[model samples]
Target: MQPPDLLFLGFFAFCAGLIDSVVGGGGLIQIPALFNALPNALPATIFGTNKIAAISGTLSAAWSYVRRVKLPWALIIPAMLAAFVMSFTGAAIVSLIPKSIMQPVVFVLLIVMAIYTFHKKEFGLLHTHLVVGRREKLLGVLSGGAIGLYDGVFGPGTGSFLIFLFIRLFSFDFLHASAASKLVNVATNAAALLYFVPTGHVLWQIALIMAVCNIMGSLTGTRLALKHGAGFVRVLFLVLLIGLIGKMGWGMLR
Candidate 1:
């Protein structure tokens, strides 16, 4: 095991916490830092460590959002539970595949996601509902469960995917979609960590410290999102999506 690089790791965790709090792409900051700081560490350990900090930030942001916004529990509760279950299953299969395959796929998806968000002139943040029926529930479960599986297996842009699925499928405003995104994301992260922790992969001391910082960052981020509202979040979401694409693509290429 590599000795932890406290300084770089802590700083990266703090930045990740803040970004994750805002729009849900914290791995863009944390994962690379871990790789650079502990280049010799096993991939699973690094991923497990990353989850330790990330889930902390996500849960904090989730609670903050729940307190501030009227969460649609009727829809989100089952979604979260379903997501958690699926994430565990995905984690079970993660090591069987190489990440190289996702590179081109994620890159193209990112470009399309950005363009779609841009071209749809008058879209999102309107809290409109174009979906109704069993289809809406299926969309949530299918998308949520599928993405939850993806989160545990790959984990680059799960948040953006969730937001996009909600916006396109449910026609929800960006704010509400983000709020829902947090709940499901927390579940997936937690579920993955459950498998990781028992395997003795997590760095507990660092995870605890990072968790504290993550919660603080989450508080600040949630407040900012609330103050700025949906349009601002939509923009930030796009930016994070790009970062995720770049980071994942670069990692795959190298």
Candidate 2:
């Protein structure tokens, strides 16, 4: 790739990281940019590169959130572990099945999520902590495993889905949901990377540059989300969900 192309991708990564750190859906930006930037690369290679870049930003955001936000470790830890394991299974499955088949399903889900979130004006506004004891842990495990699998097979809106599930199932505010989502996201990304890196699918050179840009964006986003709180994150989440819906719908149509 030329220097100009690299710059363009870096810029997109920055934007993706910023939005992803706030409420997920960064892949809605970064993945398309990667496909456009490196048309010759194999799809798996592009996906792998994306994972490497994304994981860096995710880790940074996770750390930033953990420092400031009160994470429910009992729920988060189990979820992270489940996601880590299931992500590998999802990656393995992806090697056999084409991801195109999943796009329509995901597109439909995004629409439903957007509608639900929009209609519920008070959703994700304040932390409710409805789940407690074994039920909470069970829900966390189930959500993490399912979403983590999705991330490995067809990433795109993994973060958004995670945040939404956290809010819906656990009644976490957007900020706490986002923070917990990042932890699980890091696990899923890392799990995917374990497969991709060994299979020679990642372009380390480009991924390194994108990682730096992604982290920079993550830092800025983390600060903003922390400063503004869940209300800010909720608004951004809705906007990004709209963009995700459009992107997926367009991809399916085309």
Candidate 3:
């Protein structure tokens, strides 16, 4: 049956796109929108629909950033590949393991990440790009794998974690970190999609509606980012990080 919520998919998609383009946490808005709107729908179907909408927004944001900013192809390509592979593995094991096991650990990590970002104040304001040797490359690959696994499993704060890693470990600023995070997010989603699509979980019709809305949201967010620059993105990033803590932590407790 066609999704009853398909009627306003376009609006949801546009909003997702815009929020994702700006700070990378559009899921905070879009995913809930899907669940609340599709309460009677299957959980897997909702997840699939969320992925479709997320992909649309992510691509739109990635394109928007690429057009306005210079991206680091060296790190982005390998990182994305690694994340994609890891996500696939994680998705494969989704039913085998209880993801609840890692919830508390991830929650602590998010707390640290958010606190560090908040205290640093000038952590990633300018383009820095620190690591150059094998250490740097190793960090990228390892980080990608770690975050990808998380994305495939839980998936709330992937963007925030990614941005923080790029900034702290790689010496990139907020804007640059965000640019790279988009590419990685895309890869992780693609990996999850591969597994999800086969299981017949995706509601393509509803997903399409959300995708369109996500796209619009992404475009608007990109424009705002371009206009306001790094500082504005930083503020939103911190806000989202805080929100993530509450969201994930609550989910774990409940």
In order, the Cα lDDT scores of the candidates are: 0.80, 0.91, 0.81
Model 2, position 143: C-alpha lDDT score: 93
Give candidates' CA RMSD values in order.
2.4, 1.5, 2.1
The digit string of per-residue lDDT tens for model 3 on 35-74 reads 8787898888878889988988898889888887886676
Span of ten consecutive residues with least summed lDDT in model 3: 1-10
Q: Which regions in candidate 1 have their CA more than 4 angstroms from the true location?
A: 1-4, 129-133
Error of 2 at 200 (Å): 1.6
Q: What stretches of model 3 exceed 4 Å from their correct place?
A: 1-9, 129-132
Candidate maximizing lDDT: 2
lDDT of each residue in 145-213, candidate 1, tens digit only: 888888877887788888887778777788777888988999999898898898998878767766776
How would you encode candidate 2's per-residue C-alpha lDDT over 118-204 as one tens digit per residue? Answer: 999999998985546899999999999999889877788899999999999888999999999999999999898898899999999
Candidate 2 minimal-lDDT segment of 10 residues:
92-101
How well does candidate 1 score on lDDT at residue 213? 68
Candidate 1 lDDT at 119 equals 82
Q: Deviation in angstroms for 227 in model 2?
A: 0.9
- Over 4 Å off, model 2: 95-101, 129-131
